[model samples]
Target: MYPEPVWTEWEDPDDFAEAFQLHVERHGENVYRLHKAITAQGFKIDPQTLYTWKRGDKEPRSATGLRVLKAIERRYRLPDGYFSSKLAHSGRMITGGGLEKLSVVERRRLAWHLPDNFDLLPRAKRAEILAWVRTVIISGATDYRRYHANAVLHRFSFRFSEGASPLPFPKPRPLEERLADEGAPEVGRPVQTERAPIILDTEARDLRLFKTATLTTGGRGRNGVWNDETANQKMEHLGLLFGALAACPEGEVRGYGAPVRCMTFAVLLFPAVWDWYLRWREIKRGFFTRWESEMLTVVAGLTRQGTGWLRQSPHLAGYLRPIAGLITPADIVAATEDWDGVCETIHRHAIVRAKEVDRVARVHRDPFEPILTILEADSPLGEYRKISEEVRRRRPDRRRFPVAAAEATRGYLMIRMGLHLGLRQKNLRQLLVVPRGRSPTPERQLEALKRGELRWSDRDGGWEVFVPAVAFKNAGSTFFRKSPLRLILPDLSGLYDEIDVWLRLDRKALLKTQPDPRTFFVKTVKNKSNSGAYEQHKFYEAWRSIIQRYGIYNPYTGRGAIEGLLPHGPHNVRDVLATHVLKQTGSYEQASYAIQDTPDTIAEHYGRFLPQDKAALVAQVLNQVWGS
Candidate 1:
């Protein structure tokens, strides 16, 4: 029997078996010698009982076998209750979820190279290959043989820490589901994750694809420059999308987050299913011809016409269908036909789950109150009151080419634009200070804004910034909007003065070398000829910098350098907008239009009143009840 605290907390016999397997290592397939070695450790269990325990068929209910199991755990060098964590006290990892989270490349390396009990192996020696996956886009690795999968994994650094994905990974659970012997069940509280998966400096890795695109097409390939540019960006977004899918947790549609198996399986098997369909139809072969044939037949038989797919397997076709190709949208309602009404249920749950985990940790319950107070100080053109004037000042440095002051002013302007406009991150980032038709130097752009009139060729004389349809995320979806979005900036009196000073002094310093840039927000590059116009990531970085300055941007999980920084990211700024608008106007539709979100979405996420607001209303009603 096992000693105390080793496998004592285990709820499932199978769990104990897996943990035991961790100790059964390098027996070199010698069962008799392995059993003898385990028995020598002071617990005497015959091979027969050990086999049953390994198979999880026979549970040691009585105290009779505890010492033997503990012997196996200690012999294997596993920590106490290595696989079973009922009270959530142990630190040893017993589940495959962490391994599963590694990209497709890492999973293959672990599965193919590592032993069954590799967790027991010297920790450093495992992972014979360095990287899991080298490529960003989903490769043809799902094909039958997974040709060159190892080669791909070997080329890149596939670090499998929680930081690999941008979205939050699901909380860890025991390998086998367990029910306590007594009292109410414990659904465990949310634990702070070790590292945030989302990385802000994603552009460095992501932008490489665009460089390749430019080299391949010279300008735009056959599709034209703009069209090709859009397509390339879509390819870049897939890495993050896969990470989001990876982040989904597992469990019931009602109480728990999306299941990990349910999530990864949904994507992993998606392309595999298509390959499966092709092999069945004799269009393409997988792994090898014969293995592919047998695997296909087994899968087809499982979904055989009369056997009832839902009855035999619990896998939801709806979830799989959406992700299967990753080429187009999945049919949600169709996926649920056999899902026992769980497809819609889980989909909805995933949405809500995604939102909660994605929220910034430091965001105040009333995010707007802090922002409003900051905005009210009448310092849009000046430095924040909290910081000393010596550190950062509103006054523009009149020095020739004042780089520091210029960049600071630009950052200040960008943050104010985000708050005042209540614009979505994407929209806010794409804003044009100078119309595309005009040469957009800092001076020219500032002149345009201060001119007090719309100066673009496409519109009237007032200050209206028009965003093209192609720029919208929902441009293809008819339900969301009619594009060619128009934004009217509210007339904050000192706005022109801020822009004018930035143009004449601060921004003017940066723009001294490069002239005739097209975008208002220009990055300072050493190159005199290039203004580094349209440097997209700066807008995001600027928003985050100002938020950090306020000391309000808190990440739920920790991250490294600026590249690893998630810091609620720019999207949460929209949440701030929604809450503020809803609080002031009490109109979901108005708030939605202001933020360019659907009313339903606004209501769903931000409609709930703040506790303070609710208490005030309740107090008011009570006062009325007392006949004021």
Candidate 2:
């Protein structure tokens, strides 16, 4: 669904007859040939009408004229929207795999509507689809045998039938088959998975020792005027050293004194040191993000510089601060052993950021749009009756309902919460229907879902969700911040009512085999633990998988809505909610509270209100004061 190019010079002029005559003068000889090509693309306008318009006897009026212009633009490889006025629009683009250079509108469309499913498709099949589209453009047709040529696949129903659809996943092996992930190449030495794993290597184990931790300057900031309270920290910066040792390519861990290892260790400390002092150096966070931490882990593994950091070039200052001096060569020498916390932290950060960076790097893309549109009122996000009928056609119920129905319901409910509330991944994962009393065990939660008698906090009134302070990213940090404030789950009546049905039907059915499903979300396929929480990584992967398999991505951009036809990262929910609230309310105070941030902070980053909004706000207040 590529956007129709907007002709900047000719927006709503008196008449397009002048523009039509000019086009005819330039393409006098080729006009008839272009007419034939346009006809091939399903434009049914008579050639006589085209000549009449070009000769100034009649101005072009039908949509077919627009389609002919598009065909001519492609056939001649003309500058995008070159001969366009406000009138000409084909509603399609150059239809081959190799498109003509993108127009201004096309660039915006590509940035916004790059299909999430496009990259997920297999290389050969992707070529086939692209080639099919190219053929359709040449022949000016859409239907071909059993398949249809759509710029973006219209529905994911074609997904199951695609037979060769390439999902971006290693085929899932049953948990038993992956006991050791035997065939996968070791990234560094193999890591552990047991809760509280022990890193067998000795140098890394030092992080757990009390002596390895240092008592850094405590109480308040170095200057009391800067921060309200300065709490001293007892930190084990040795884990920072462990980051490099464990991150090295498999054989390099033991060769700590090697020049290459020395350089890698120093390089690792540079970002960690720069992280503490330079506040806004990182994106979207007051402090260093897990992305920085993960970047260090990758630098250690991939780069093989030999003590180049010791050369004293001013360039080194870009990464290293004076604090890096405290981490000496001996510290690197002593860091041969690996610890569980160090490895797990590095690995988890790597996994999370890998997905995060891809979307973040593409500044304005929203890969979640198609799915979100389908979730609108009366679509899958609500009663899901349309989706139910679709599924029921293909799936025979094995139990009370088909497995497809259960998965679809659960997925729809999860996405709806994200769009409506802007909840974070962890916040969604830690949700509890058994309210704020003594927390419910897995057995109790399971029983509650099945019986439909959830332990509501009648004290706080029913359906109150208590988000623990520990869930905040800043929870354990002693950085500049305000008092911890607990957030109330936004009260949306019909929304919570949907949760009731999900728990009773979808969730219960998914976990029916598990003797104990500890968390609200359980694994679709059996893995390690009997029934455990859906980890953040798994939650995002599932969301993406479901969206690509079931929805559509819009080709048009500039909808001026927050969520559109493409899928986005789970973290973007907070952004979508904050920006949307600001656009609607025009108050930073309202946006801050909605996103759980300070007013200044919300204005600095999250909100995207227009300048006109401020002018409107002033008028609104004056009207309120004087009774408009």
TM-score of each: 0.37, 0.41
What is every candidate's alpha-carbon RMSD to the true fold? 27.1, 19.6
Over the stretch 1-628, how does candidate 2's per-residue lDDT look in tens digits?
1223333233333234555554444444445765676777776888888787665555433334544665665654455555443232112223222334556565333322222233335767546655543332122222321132331132110001111112222232343332222222224442211111121112122211211223212111111111101110111122323332333234322212111112222333333333322232233222344445444434332222221111211122122112222343333223222222233333444445445544443323222233334333222233222232322222222242335456756665665655554555766665545533545334444333321213445565555433433344434333214333333344464555555666666666666666634455554645455454576668877664443333322222111222233433466556556655665577787776665566786676655555775676567778897874
Report how far residue 292 has shifted in candidate 2, in Å: 6.1
Off by over 4 Å in 2: 1-201, 208-401, 419-421, 435-455, 459-461, 476-493, 527-530, 549-564, 610-628
**lDDT (Cα atoms) of all candidates against the true structure:** 0.40, 0.40
| Model 1: per-residue Cα lDDT at residue 127 | 43
Q: After superposition, how far is residue 611 of candidate 2 from its true place, in Å?
A: 3.4
Highest TM-score scorer: 2
- The runs of at least 3 residues in candidate 1 whose Cα sits more than 4 Å from the true structure, single-residue gaps closed, are 1-396, 435-462, 476-483, 504-506, 527-531, 549-568, 605-608, 615-628
